[model samples]
Target: MKKRLIYGWLLAGVTFASSCTKNFDEVNTDPYKATSENFNPNFLMSQAQIQFSQTGYDQLLFQSMWVQSLASTFDYYANGDKYVLRGSGTGYYSRTWNRGYGALTLVDEMKNLVQGKTQYSNLDACGTILRVMFIQRITDLHGDVPYSQEGQAKSGNVAPVFDKQQDIYKAMLSQLDAATAALDLNKDKPSSDLFYGGDISKWKRLGYSLMLKAAMRLTKVDAATAKTYAEKAYAAGTMTSVADNAKVLTDNANGNSNSNSDALLVADDFREVRWGKTLIDIMKTSNDPRISAVAEVSAGTGKAANEDRATPGVNTASLQIGMPNGYDLNGGATDISKAPNYPGTSPANPAVPNDAPAPVGKYSRPRLTVYDDRSGVNMLYTYGESELLLAEAAVRGWNTGSAATHYANALAADIRSLAQMNATPQAVVSDNDIASYVSRNPLNTANTTALQQINTEYYVVTSTTFNFNETFANWRRSGYPVLTPVTYPGQYITGSIPRRMPYPITLPQTNGANYQAAVANQGPDNFATRVWWDKQ
Candidate 1:
């Protein structure tokens, strides 16, 4: 019953095209089986748009734990929860690499199909924007990646050299700038454009917004360039409101639902995930209304005799607690009952018998009604994120806007966007609450704490939504709201939180020379080595 994007119809068209093409190929007997010219560019664009937003099962397993927004109570999830990167844990690295490059290949095919075609100039621009988006994610994960020589297997360069992160950033910014400027509204647009629905104006906003994000990322490392692009992006019209958010919609149907919902539905292990103590503590301290919107009360109240019980799954801001990271049943205690501060107060534990419920469900899980809802929107970029980044730009003396106004606007947009996740009345943040939160948490004018304040708010905003990758990246760049590194017994990287993910294990065997070259140029192929932009 949910509103579906037009992808289904487009996919059917692609299928029909494929079936019809077989007859033509059989009759012609051309040396090459098929060419890019044989396919509709819209179909390629549709696939790229969908694939670009597809984070799949890896995000819930790895990113959520890495950012400390979610944690696991069982040994099964200890690999990720405790930073143990062995056998199964290493799968996260491989899955992300595969998905990212797989999507980029489709974008490359689309680019090849539309390149140098005067009539499809706008489509070409769209392809470039998508390429930048896809490649940025890859470079962010691993410092040096195959950018220039990527997807060039047909050109006979199977072993492409790795591009440095700095070079990649420069190229991405240039591409975005050119692509955004080249998007002509009068030109024909793709009918299957899922993100913008063929609206060139919104596509332009998304392109500039991505530019803003790339520039802000270099704040610590390259202040001058960061300032330059941030100003240019703002002038070119970055996302200004929730209406301009670049989100992909779902229909709540099989094979068409939100990726997060799909993962949660099929994987029983994912159900073990609950809110992390670090995030919950901050939200509870600030009395953030988003906590109730994002998380639910423990299903089972571990209370003894004569205890008053609170209703399960109630949206009481005070009753929601989170499980701590980096402890398993075998590590210290027999179970949740024996663990110190079993479902401790602050966000109070449920009122059920101590031994009655499983430890995993004994604490708060993410709000299933919203987050796990199949019809939910997968937010890629948003006005809230842009405003927060701009707020930081203002703090850095960039000619964007007043820090106070941007900060207030960021808070308001974030609250309003959460309401759009579902029609739950409790999730809808009131204007009074928005105004009050903004007023209370005004940007710290003092230079010493201004950047910290802005980045910390960025963390809070990204946590409620499914922006864990950005949350981790910003944390590394800004180092705000200082997080404690978990020192679990069998942790792989010790003494600090991860700076970047390890390269996929298959890289050495698949592309040994290039893999070694990248490892040598960028620091050792390990989690502790900082990426180029993460100078802080």
Candidate 2:
């Protein structure tokens, strides 16, 4: 089945010659190879799912640094950490853009193949859900993208016009509504489905959850629409527990391993990353037990001789400390160890030698065994996120459940999710721990601080799960956690954090007119410009 999926994917990229030769005969064609005419929609769907997972996971590699969930000690990401644009020559922006649009093409093909066919209506609905997921990420990163006419290159529409972010959002919401409603239980399901295993109910829940997410993104710009969709989503049935989470399960096989684990193993410096101070300090002050589940104790030389020096570091919660953002390797190494309430097992010199190696391992890093585990699951949407959004919806006077109940459920779900993802004995979060944490952190009734508290908890939840894209977007929308802007030397956007990534450089060359229009409509193609949803 997997081999067929791969063959179909390969064939999807093939462009056969329009004119056939007189010599064309049976011997000229390969009988076993799949082609566009004979490709299975199920195989195409499977490939799309895998590519979508890869695209989403890759965003964390850099966006996590932007949100301060993880600090980079390596020079390669120093400029990115400080919000500096690496220029058109840098592949980060272009690579992400290509991956998103590439996946959309596969999805478009799958939808075209299955549409108007009753037997494949459910599969077509899945394609719609996948389309929304991919396009949303693109518009979020680079406002005013080629949406309405995208994936029409074969039809001679190479330079597709860019659509406004508002229009894109509206269209996506409508498509999701129709797609979820079109799901029929009587239809045949694809056995090769990667996310829900061809289960229509799970896909329906995911569609509603995605709709809720889209609605929340509009809170800053269009509260009325946000409220309307939020209510509809709840009624449509959103994810309510960890069991309903939309994730792509991966194995330890060579080509199927988790992307995060693969990247960690191949990173230039094994310890280039450490827990960010913003996250660790919040966890410590609140006595959050999930902190131990996420981080490992420092392995600095200053620790006691008998201290455990495990490969991923020790699992002592009290001994974990996070690295602060904005400083260079040497500066961070010296400054972090001297900060007030430093909790690392080892304390480094207040001033280290200029030539000394970065003291990254001296500070706490993410629990390696779990984050770098080959068989880990890649979460797309979670019950915790759904509950948190419900809490926000209630606060907004929407017809969701009680804010307090949703808040508590969100916390419990987050804790359970952490333990479930990482089965290490030391990282376990027992029922007692969840109960104690929930009891200690009840929702505040004061309206003034209620939103702040809710979003702050969201920041912590996203940090632990490495869901930095949503974390950054939420921070922009709610303005919670009150993070200080970094003002490092050579920074591109000074005095404030970046709001959006610039468009890829190839845009002007390939689609000049449309690109110019988009740039003119959406402020200068720069990081400082805000998207439509991020209203001032």
| Backbone clashes, each candidate | 5, 0
Worst 10 residues of 2 by lDDT: 301-310
Candidate 1 collision pairs: 301-350, 301-351, 301-352, 302-352, 303-352
Model 1: per-residue Cα lDDT over 1-536, one tens digit each: 23344777778889988888759766567756567667777787878777767675556676677778778755556656778754477777877677778888888887888877887888889888988888887788778999989999988988889999999999999999999999999999867887888899989999999999999889878999999999999998998788888777766665767777677555444446678888888888877878777887544343321021223355677777777787665535534445557764222245432434345555677776777777777777789889988888988788998888988898889888887665343357788888888788888878658887788878887777777777788888888768888777667788888888889998899899999988888888988899999965
Query: Which residue runs of candidate 2 sit more than 4 Å off their true CA positions?
Result: 1-29, 55-57, 85-89, 298-310, 331-358, 422-427
lDDT of 2 by residue, 279-350 (tens): 888899989998778888544443231122235567678877777876554545335444555443344334
Q: State candidate 2's TM-score.
A: 0.87
Where in model 1 is the C-alpha error above 4 Å? Answer: 1-35, 252-254, 266-271, 299-312, 331-340, 344-355, 360-362, 422-426
